[model samples]
Target: MTMTMTMTRSLTGAMAAELTSLRDRVLDAAVVCVDRGGLGRISLEDVAAQASVARATIYRHFPGGRDQLIREAVDREVGRFWRDLAVSVRHLDGIEARLVAGLVEARARLEGHALLQRLLRQEPGDIVSVLAESGPAVYEVLATYLEDLLSIERLRDGVDRREAAEYLARLVVSHISVPGGWDLGDEPAVRRLVRRQFLAGVIDGIEPDR
Candidate 1:
């Protein structure tokens, strides 16, 4: 019975791994389609063809159809951006430095991203609407990363790290979405804004001398 149970568990794990790999392949195919012919030109059929999978197989993985697949692809892209940002700021000493570096990197990344530029140019409203719908989830991702940075820097005192992270994340997103009067293009200005507006309260209880 124990051996039988172990074999079952192993099989289940293998199936899960395969499913994950298949999903990634589908998403990669979707990304390729988007890159090749912008967001508005792609369809589930296109994705399936590009992925070399049947339409039914694509639907099996993404039950919500094309929109769901697009959302997941965007999420994966955002996750990759954050991972790259994390690496960019990994060696920075303090949370404040990291925050400044992160914001700068994020702005640069967004401005320079080819896929995002294409989407913005060809299907601006669709991408903007999708981003609005995904705003909370994006904030949560940023806040979670901020929490890790705070913990690592040993600066998670006094302030509610999660709340502070959310606030800071919103601030970053707002700047990205609409510069309004702020010149987000200037790294020095962005750093000053991050330090004065966000990090000040985040490290509120830390001693000035420290």
Candidate 2:
């Protein structure tokens, strides 16, 4: 009886893994469809065709349909952004550098992400809806990260690290919301401007002497 139970559990785990793989394929197909033709042009049938899976299969993985799938895609992309930002933070020593690098890297990344570009330009309404509804989750993650980063970096004596971090995060996200929002032309330019304006300004403006 114990052997039978163990076998059943193993089989269940394997099936779960396989299902996850299939779901990822469907999501990838949806991204490809959106990349090629934009969200308005993508459909359940289009996703199924792109994924080479049955329409029912796609629906089974994402029962909420098109909106839910799109949201999932956006969340996945946002997760990647956060993860990459975290990695980048580890390599830098100063709070200001980390803050600027994170946003500048985000801008470069947002430019290449297909769904993000579409949201920035073509479907601003939907993008706004997502941000309004989903913003708190993003803020929570960012706040936790900033707290840790500030403590470790020991940012300058005068810096209101919390407000500065908040401002920079929001600024980066705002840039993502609008296509061609930052005219920096390159990452270094973005890094320079954000460091000078957002980071330095926050620290300078907060000093008691000022």
| Model 1: pairs clashing at backbone N, Cα or C within 3 Å | none
lDDT (Cα, 0-100) at 122 in candidate 2: 91
- Residue-level lDDT of model 2, residues 1-210, one tens digit each, is 999999999999999999988988888888888888876667999989989999988778899999878788767766777888779777887666676666666666767776666666897776768657668878778766766666655455666777767776676567654535456446666666665655556544323221
Off by over 4 Å in 1: 151-159, 179-186, 205-210
In order, the Cα lDDT scores of the candidates are 0.82, 0.72
Error of 2 at 122 (Å): 3.2
**Cα misplacement distance, residue 113 of candidate 1 (Å):** 0.7
TM-score of each: 0.85, 0.73
Top TM-score prediction, candidate number: 1
The weakest ten consecutive residues by lDDT in model 1 span 201-210
